[model samples]
Target: MTDLPVRIRPEIAALPPYRQGKQAGDEAFKLSSNENPFDPLPGVLAAVQAAGSFNRYPDASAARLRDRLAERHGVSPDGVHVAAGSVSILYQLTQAAAGPGDEVVFAWRSFEAYPGLAVVAGATAVPVPLTADGRHDLVAMADAVTDRTRVVIVCTPNNPTGPTVTQAEFDAFVAAVPGDVLIVLDEAYAEFVTDPDAVRGDAVRAAGHDNVVILRTFSKAYGLAGLRVGYAIGHPSILDAARTTGIPLSVIAAAEAAALASLDAEDALRERIDAIVERRDRLAAGLRAAGWDVPDAQGNFVWLSTGAETLDVAAAFAEAGLIVRPFAGDGVRISVGEEESVDRVIAIAASVVESLPQTHAGRR
Candidate 1:
């Protein structure tokens, strides 16, 4: 075959591939994707079961779900944008706000998708490393902004590292950011957070910040990962821009039904959240007690900083029929799931830690 044109965008070609946890079939305890371990909330299964109009197309506007979300968040329906998943919303946001010469800023190792989304949008990604304590270095991120900075993503109770950005820190960061730059807060795991200091997206919008967009997903706390529903709350104009670049409408419908059902089961969902929190704390303590350096996790997962031995620990867990997420050069992130799964993970982790050699060289 003749040589293909070397016309592909440099950013797209240079982007690192997105990696997910190993699929479920190979392992007994799969706690890699940060998914809610609970079964679908009451009425959720029935609602999805009732969604049988496979012949007809879904509502293009996602009007009902938009209305529900708007009412819940106390915003006009025009200010809401629904998509197949929050990641789709993120992609749309990048397309709407960043391009060619613009830059997108976020904490390094926060969300793997942020950098890839920035590259695809033809924008430069400026990643500010997290604090030594694994929290977002908001001050450093704010300082990284320049005239070309078009968007910034703050992932509260951040991925991998679970500490949240406090309201005070968020308020200060917002004040420091220029009005023209869009700040997208990805609160995918918001429902699981119980800290008084955690920043709520609804509170952010109610403060009347036009440049801010708050993203939420039904996948985590809502227990709707298979349905793929997520949304954004922002200025109407910004929502309009995101809508123009988003996915098909049917995915939107299933997501809407799942989300509405989830809201209806709020009490039950909260109980599940409480369970997850309890499990997370117990798991973290168990890991620490076993001599693993586990972070204070506030999300549904805990981080283990094993340095170069991260992959070895991951392999050991897999060998024991467990699955966990390993971050190159960073650490491993193990999700808190059902009681049995959590126990299996703790057991596997304890064995892995105990078996490791004392020195880095010995471990290697």
Candidate 2:
């Protein structure tokens, strides 16, 4: 590799950049990114179209959207902070709370962005392995924390793998950590969760855990992925620090308006969410019947731990006109998409599952 003209941090240079799911061709279904497959509600589209003049900067504070979210979550406007997306807020929080000589802990094989965020903050990343069934090992995560630890992130219905942390598990983990440490609950896919026992961030905050910060996004269930609006609910003091680190005017006018309109039309959106949930369950069942050990998927996706067969299986999916996300030797994550895509995915899986090694973990 060639050397840079200016001196750059070796760690930053060594880190791999975040990769998004592959885009699909015209005829293929894009089941790679965990995006909501529904179209924007009429109200939401109108709000974005009628948003403030493009000539001026968006409200630097996004006060109206903050106020709306605060009311819904039973917090003051100051307790809420909005940004381009929850992932951006993650960067801001890491920058605000951790730095050189500090550490950030989260589950490995979870969100692909966590490790990079820590490195970007000039902090060491401590990634605890998930359990064999794909749920977070919260006990191990709490044990990983140390004096140098500044932040702990818990991603529920963990991306790529769909199992969630229970309320009991979250409570126990929070009790294990010191109050001074920041606990970020990255619930980007929370709206897609269906399990009654899964931990809810709103309930956690209501129970009075000031150290906990709940991060949510309109990108998924609200179909606002293009606008990139997301927010955090936490103590004002904690949010204030993240705000200081945030890029000014990152949450633009159209995004804020779209978010507010989506909130108003949430009832209609839930119908769409319900349909996806139904489809996700059926798809998982079909894969299981085909002799695959699919995890308990509560989110709008399913994980097939194909192990060494990952690339081959993903290739088969693409050949079947479905674009899925693969993690080399790990597994493949196929998002719950159009009604027809579910049957198409399982139809392809029926053939691929048989070709897996008999001893593979994903094979039942």
Candidate 3:
């Protein structure tokens, strides 16, 4: 038979798929993905159960949830836009703003979605390297933006590395960017940040900046990763642009109910966060005491910078029935979870680090 028309978009053809945490076997302790190990809050579960009429479509506008979010964040409903998840909102924003000849910029080793989204939107991705301390090199990122730059994503408390950009740094970076270019601040791990100087992107957006968009998700602290609900706070025009891109209504329903319920269960969520934070500190101290290069992880996870052979340590952990997210040559990221899980991860990490040759050095 004659070859079927084999034309596909060149950008898509050349793009690499985003890698997620591996789920090898049921026995594996799944710490590869930075997901909250706690169960959904009681209120959130009740809300989901009450939402039994699956026959009806969700409120496309997500009016109720939006209003709740507005109150919580001290913003108007017009500034809020809900989607299936933060990633979905990001994809829509990329498609809406980035196109041929435009460039998307973000820090290297940040959220993995930035590059793929840029490629999908037919834009050039400019990845600036992170600072020596593993925080976003905001100055370098701002300097990387040019006339062709359409979107710049800043993932603070970054995925692999847990360091966050300070408020002053973020302010300076935003001031340096062109007003027309969209600045996406992906704050997926915002809830875990205890630093008083940490940048709260939502507050930045609320201050009347037309170019800034703050993306947040219920998947983290709310224990609603499976619900796939997230929202963006930004200028009304930007929100309108993203909303124009259609999202599935069913996902929206589950997200809205769960998010609203999560809001009501703030105390329970706070307790969960406290526990995770304590565990994170304990694990970090434990790893450090064992002579491992563990950083001050402000998120619900820790990073072990074993330099070039991070994969070896990751494999060692895997062999011990622990699945960790390895950034190949970069480092291994281990998610903080329940007390027992956290202790087990630290124990395994200590053993792995000790077993590795002393030649494998750690970086900042």
Candidate 4:
């Protein structure tokens, strides 16, 4: 397509383009991206305003933020690695651990970014399908690993479809994999998980796993998505390898300041998170009562198995002034948005579910 003679990797060219969640107009409830509906905590806003040194570059290592995260996770500062976002760290870890002739294992219909990241790193993507209720088939994922498998990623409170792996499930899966294969537990929605049995990464790391990396973010519960500050906790040697792949000076001062401030205002932040969790549970309950096969939603969103009518159901929500993320034929993902949007979402969902045949996949 270009006049200039340039060589491009065919695999890269074949990868699907990344699409962001649809933006909403002023009158619409933008629930497509699972963003925290709450505005930044007042203390965090103050910190961002106080960081006025735009003329200077940020600390490349992000030592302050790293230390803060280490303290929270009860790890040494050297074990913590900071990056712009956890997704950015995923790409780095994939690049660091895998290459041509190697493979990366994760669940299908999980994070939309996983396949592309593996492709870019020149590793083959081996996606195990999710179970009917949308939870990962961890046994299948563990079985997929071969001698050539370089990395295994487990996403808890899985994105798009919201079901988390239990601690027992995670332990069995980990035991099945070879110790040489690096395991990355992506817990971006950890703060929102209300499930008593869900696997928490910090607990796993505390048990002395040398090859596991726990990835987390300030983007969700802490309301710092715009600033893009995420951190990883693992063995320092593994983190040192990942650090080599990151872009220089990417985690800026504003993000670090906002994260630190959010940590300081933990009680207020937890209150807001409590509100979101309550609303999320209510929304999922309402959807299921209305005859939809709503999955276990431990995150701040619910998954509707809309199946073949995914796009149509998504359009109906948009028409009713509620934006949702749809994965074409698979299903639609609706975030637990503002309190005002809840009734509208439930109303539209009920109407849509009634139209489907009782035997349809989305129906209960």
Off by over 4 Å in 3: 1-5, 248-250, 355-359
Candidate 2 on 1-364: residue-level lDDT in tens?
2578888888988998899999999999999999889999659888988997999999999999999999999999999999999999999999999999999999989999999989999999999999999999999999999999999999998998999999999999999999999999999889888889999999999999999999999998888888999999999999999999999999999999999998999679889889999999999999999889999998889999988889999999999899999999899999999998988999899899888778889988
Clashing residue pairs in candidate 3 are none
lDDT (10s digit) by residue, model 1, range 24-77: 664467888998888999999888777657777878888888899899999999
lDDT of 4 by residue, 1-364 (tens): 3443777788876777889899999999999989999999869888988876899998899899889888888989999999999999998899999999999999989999999888999989999999999999999999899999999999999998999999999988888999899999999999999899999898889878788999999988888989999989999989999999989899999899998999998789889999999999999998988889999999999999988999999999999999999999899999988999988898999999998888998898
Least accurate stretch of 10 residues (summed lDDT) in model 2?
1-10
For model 4, the stretches where C-alpha displacement exceeds 4 angstroms are 1-5
Better of 1 and 2 by TM-score: 2
Q: Which TM-score value belongs to model 1?
A: 0.94
**TM-score computed on alpha carbons, candidate 4:** 0.98
Candidate 3 Cα RMSD (Å): 2.3
For model 1 the local lDDT of residue 278 reads 89
Q: Best to worst by TM-score, what's the order?
A: 2, 4, 3, 1
The candidate that wins on lDDT is 2
Residue 98 Cα positional deviation in candidate 3, in Å, after optimal superposition: 1.0
Root-mean-square deviation per candidate: 2.6, 0.9, 2.3, 1.1
